[model samples]
Target chain A: GAGVSQSPRYKVAKRGQDVALRCDPISGHVSLFWYQQALGQGPEFLTYFQNEAQLDKSGLPSDRFFAERPEGSVSTLKIQRTQQEDSAVYLCASSQLVEGGEPQHFGDGTRLSIL
Target chain B: AQSVTQLDSQVPVFEEAPVELRCNYSSSVSVYLFWYVQYPNQGLQLLLKYLSGSTLVKGINGFEAEFNKSQTSFHLRKPSVHISDTAEYFCAVSLDYKLSFGAGTTVTVRA
Candidate 1:
């Protein structure tokens, strides 16, 4: 089975610009999560979605960060007015069950460089 | 909120030698402990997880970790390491649906 997949593996954006990163979770996966990974650091959670509902977004650093998963399988993390500090790799993960304690499968991630 | 700490930023060990990566976590509630490995130019993959039951949990690539409640630690260890085991190891804690991660420990295995 195919694991999670993210589009535009590398994106270079100007400061103050907007960028949207897409994620395609594995088929039939019910849970999706977004995370940010800076260089030489582990990944930090950003937001999570169960189906179409965005359950957790507390990890989002600022209001400029937004995410949506309308249909359930695919999700998009949008950053408005990107800053140099937003330069990092955006990771997406999906899992089968939440309460059952299933492991989340991660995607390759999109590396965004803000110049 | 939960937080994870990896004591060592880097651990250099000779091939076929024993290695240990220390990890400690803090949380107000019960949490799930996990160890993940990331090779160069790749995303993380779960090495093992301790949700409940035995404190000693075995993971992939001959890796294992022991969950110590009193110490608030889950340190990964391998009796004999191979060169292929050289990579970044991350310790993570999850309370409810949120996941917290440590900075990560890079293990360099020298032949």
Candidate 2:
């Protein structure tokens, strides 16, 4: 992929329903990240993956949110028992290198609406 | 711990006018600073970053940011802005490998 690609640009789920968003990072990207953006707010870090290992999950809001990049190429963000407050844009970004100075390429993101 | 604060929530400027978006950060250790822009209905795009070398970093679309270590600020500035420059701008700080972002400032360029 030329850039990070996210699936299901929009999602609407009833409360308590499970939703899964997908991300296909640029080919050969070593670092993958997930973020949550609320209305009128900046993207907040959620989790990160270097290759297949989940390096940091401290920023995950709660147990309900889980992310996995099994093959280091594509990733999935799953939210269980969604709530009204869970409505937000789920952003996925990828970097060619895992180091701090590398630039990150971001996908348009999946807008999740919990009703 | 690292945190970023964007001083302005909204900035409105006439077309072809100079504009500045203020950002400040607090950190215990040396950090990398960045500016990202987000257009309506789009994801964030990196504007510029200050990694190690220069304090003044130039980015795409004629946007530039200066890293001031003494003040702990990385403010984005443009000598002249167009209506296309209207977007939400975010300042970020990275310590180690984790990145922290500011609330964001919205730039609206008017005719």
Candidate 3:
């Protein structure tokens, strides 16, 4: 892909329903990241993957949020039993090199609305 | 731990005027500073970053930022502005690999 790509640009889920968002990173990107952005706030880190290895998950807000980058290319962010507070934009970013100093390209993001 | 604070929630400037967005960060260890811009309905794009070599870092769209370790600030500035420069700007700090972001500042460049 020319840039980071995310699927289902918008989503509306009923409370208690599960939602899954996908991210397709640039080819050969070594690092992938997931973030959550509230209506009027900046993006907050959720998780990170260096290739196929999950290096950090400390930013995941709760047990309901889970992310996986299987096979090291495509990543998925799944939220279980969505709540009203879960409504926000889910963003994906990819970096060519290591984290420091390297620019991370971001996807437009998936806007999730828990109805 | 690393955290960023963007001082202004909103800034209004006319086209061709100079603009500045204030940012400050706190970290226990060495950190990387970055400014990112988000256009309407678009994802964030890196404006500039301060790593090590220099205190002043220039970025695309005529934006620049200076890293001040003593003050723990990395403020974005532009000598002149255009209407297209209206966007939300975020300040972020990275320690090791994890990044922490500020609340963000929205800049509206009026015509």
Candidate 4:
């Protein structure tokens, strides 16, 4: 695809249910980032990947929040136990060059609704 | 670590009127500032950025921002705004790699 693409534009899960959100970054993008955006709030960084290596996971909110990029093309963000507070829009962004100073192109995002 | 603050939670303005969105950041090291606009049901789009060189940076859609190092602020402005400019604006600062963002401000441009 020409731009970053995300799967399951909308996802709904019961409390305590596990859910996985997927992101397909632009082809040949070297840097990928995942973020969580709550109601009326800006997107918060969750994790970052440089190629196949997860360079930064410090932004992950908790142990339940896990992300991986096996082939360095697609990424997944898994939440072990869903909670009502976990409801938010999950955003995926990919940058063509290095992480620093390069503007990231974002996807439409997956709107996760935890019931 | 870097943190951002968007002072105005919401701003309502008339069409063709000028507006300003304020953002302030706190960082120990040098900062990279950015402004992103998020339309409804869409992801954020980069409005402008300040990495190095002149503090005044211009971006897409006639939007511009000034990076005030001493004040630790990067406020976005436009001479005149249209109804299409209504959206959520975010201010972010990157110290290393991870970008820390503000709470966001909702801008409504009434016709």
> Which residue ranges in model 1 land beyond 4 Å of their true spot?
none
Candidate No. with top TM-score: 2
Kindly list the per-residue Cα lDDT of model 3 for residues B56-102, writing each as its tens digit: 99999999999888999999999999998999999998876667899
Whose TM-score is higher: candidate 1's or candidate 2's? 2
- RMSD of every prediction: 1.0, 0.8, 0.9, 1.0
Weakest lDDT window of 10 consecutive positions for candidate 4 chain B? B92-101
Could you tell me every candidate's TM-score relative to the true structure? 0.97, 0.98, 0.97, 0.97
Q: Distance (Å) between predicted and true CA of A109, model 1? A: 0.8
Model 4 Cα lDDT, one tens digit per residue, A1-115: 7999998899999999999999999999999999999988889999999999998898788898999999998999999899899999999999988857888889999999999
Error of 1 at A51 (Å): 0.4
Residue lDDT tens for model 2, A63-111: 9999999987899999999999999999999998977778888999999
Candidate 4 local distance difference test against the native: 0.93
The sequence of per-residue lDDT tens digits that candidate 2 reaches over residues B1-111 is 889999999999999999999999999889999899999888899999899888899999999999999999999999999999999999999886667899999999999
Model 1 CAPRI quality: medium
Residue-by-residue lDDT tens digits, candidate 3, A14-74? 9999999999999999999999999999999999999988899998999999999879999
Which window of 10 residues has the lowest lDDT sum in candidate 3 chain B? B92-101
- In model 3, which regions exceed 4 Å deviation? none
Candidate 3 chain A lDDT trough over 10 residues, lowest sum: A96-105
